[model samples]
Target: MAAGAPRIFVSHLSGVAVFDPAGDQVGRVRDLVVMLRVAQRPPRLLGLVVELATRRRIFLPMTRVTAIQSGQVITTGVLNVRRFEQRPTERLVFGELLDRRVVLTETGEEVTVLDLSVHQLPARREWEIDRVFVRKGRKGSAFRRAKGEALTVEWTAVSGFSLEEQGQGAENLLATFEQLRPADLANVLHHLSPKRRAEVAAALDDDRLADVLEELPEDDQIEILGKLKEERAADVLEAMDPDDAADLLGELPTDEQERLLSLMQPGDAADMRRLMSYEDRTAGGLMTTEPIVLRPDATVADALARVRNPDLSPALAAQVYVCRPPDETPTGKYLGTVHFQRLLREPPPSLVSSIVDSDLQPLDPDADLPAIAGFFATYDMVAAPVVDEAGSLLGAVTVDDVLDHMLPEDWRETEFHLAEEEVATDGS
Candidate 1:
């Protein structure tokens, strides 16, 4: 739903047919998977448990859900057909939450939960269970049978559903730190014992773990990845940024790397393989294969919409590469660049090619680290396109990648140590 759509009660979504972009029915949503948070904070709506035609159930992440219309759910068409397994921190909304008894925090009145309401947060694609639909008077089956006072209240008004802030286990700890930045979360993980670290890593959803792994030290990344189930490891790798995922895969044993690659989606595996073929410090090595690419005929509005994607980093979103036909990288031709600023200044209907910044030179795939750094410094560019000799746009290198490669290998360790020292100083 768009920003204007009303908050929807979960009951309305029961057994909703889910469809791909092509209008083909993929499956029916059997249940919603939500992660409960500490205190009275609303739980995050993780995704849906979808049952396929053959009765196989798979987990569909909230990220892949594009829309929920009157009677059907729309997806991005990408799916992982693995069986849905509930994690320690996950609760099935249909199986675990409904027909449960809860208490109103203020009035101390017991109520039976009939359903919950979910709202998609406006800024990003994340959705959360924000409201509870409950009925008062007699509890249990009696309440279901008899008419009773029913009202929808903010999720915070009910106290029974939240996991306690002081509760034991990694799930509780994970809930407490749910709002942390990935870097801060990585620091927390760095300080946790090996077993606790593994527990927390396992509890995190694939996207979250991918973010944390990117910020972690190389050794820690390997350690955490090694502890994950092989299939889960592959899923997490696919969730990660292509460049970071490639770097992680490059560090693994050849046999293990192949094993994980075999589990990943073919397209993602191909990107990893291509990236691994490049020298570690070269432009090809550092660039992401998923840079936003648009055909010359695409409008500024189209570019703006692509840039607005929440998954992209600021560097990646800074500019969009305009190319020829075959918008996917390596695109047909390295046409030119259209910086975000330029897109903003132009009329929405303006063709991207009309205002392209053709003068700035693109980087060669084999451009060395120092050379890439110099290009960024000389152009004062946050990101620059990488083009091959055949004039196809290979990818785009961002300044962040350059900084990552230029930094000392032990930098994350140093940062973790410094954070620990500061915390100890505060305690002292």
Candidate 2:
């Protein structure tokens, strides 16, 4: 159970029969279900689907198994009859496993795995359990625990399996999706093409896809939007940031944009239109409309109270933002930001001005790409504050937005070479 350990091939896994310690025969293994495709390490077996004599299928986790005997597999955990309960037709396959917490024994890392992918191998015309990706914990958490461990274990290393023995395991996975790492998820989305992006969007229910879409890049955003029907696209847009919604609509053809906008709720459409009018690089354009705002005179204690509120936006809750009273120009009178970590370390009754940044540089609304890039590199900031000529805070530009404009010249060339090699192998 190390990083990049080679697992025994599925060809070597045939005829592994299953039985109980009481010597009651259960079923034989049919095939493996690998969730990941391209992994840094070996795959994880989700479980074995035993073909029962009654024409029913029993899902058994490899961890429940005690030994792989020549003719029968011995198990320690009793197969619960309740687990065989059929879900209603409305539920998705593996719906209960998403966002669940799992003790990844191999890496000793704990995280909620947001989703599971199944991989089908073409060579053996067989399926194998694949990789498991970890979700990152919340921002500004004191512990900063990793969502998943880096090490990958073969399906065989699973020593045991059971829910809390109090509840079902499937239920646990669904509750932890929000704890997943947005960046890792962004990378997973990055590897997919427009076609596959469309397929994935189609397969996922709108609510689940909406959650995942917010973590993806603008390019991927455009691709997913393009593929979805007008109503479906509108639903996702409704859940996204106003700025994100605008950016996605702007990328579409003008007629289609109007059509999509028409399909959206009136309130959502209006907000998107407002954000769309500004240049994408501007603070007014990129800043989320949903930032947590407080009067300049609010005490740090009051701010802390607000931060702890679950209703506050995750971004602003992690890093508190202070602003002057809403005037004719909101951006011209904007104040500085303080990390939530900083607030926790200091006295609670401190005034907002004491923690506010006095000399923070504000971004120009119309600053070109190089200037924006220079600002990020200059400040070494994960997010840079944006402002107009009046010295008001408009919005913030994130490192991810900068990355959209900075692709390497040889990126496609490298991909082309890989594609050519694939073609050659197939021809041979």
Candidate number of the best lDDT: 1
TM-score of each: 0.96, 0.48
Every model: Cα RMSD to truth: 1.6, 18.3
How close to the true structure is residue 160 of candidate 1, measured as C-alpha lDDT?
A: 89
How accurate locally is residue 184 in candidate 1, as Cα lDDT from 0 to 100? 99
Cα lDDT tens digits for candidate 1, 261-365: 999999899999999999989999999999999988899999999998788999999999988979878789888999999989999999999999999889999
Tens-digit lDDT track for model 2 on 12-89?
344566678788777666544323212123233445556666656665544355555355667754452212323211
Candidate 2 has its poorest 10 consecutive residues by lDDT at 82-91
The residue ranges of model 2 lying beyond 4 angstroms of the native Cα positions read: 1-89, 92-199, 203-207, 214-223, 265-267, 280-286, 305-318, 326-332, 390-392, 408-428
Off by over 4 Å in 1: 140-144
lDDT value, candidate 1, whole model: 0.92
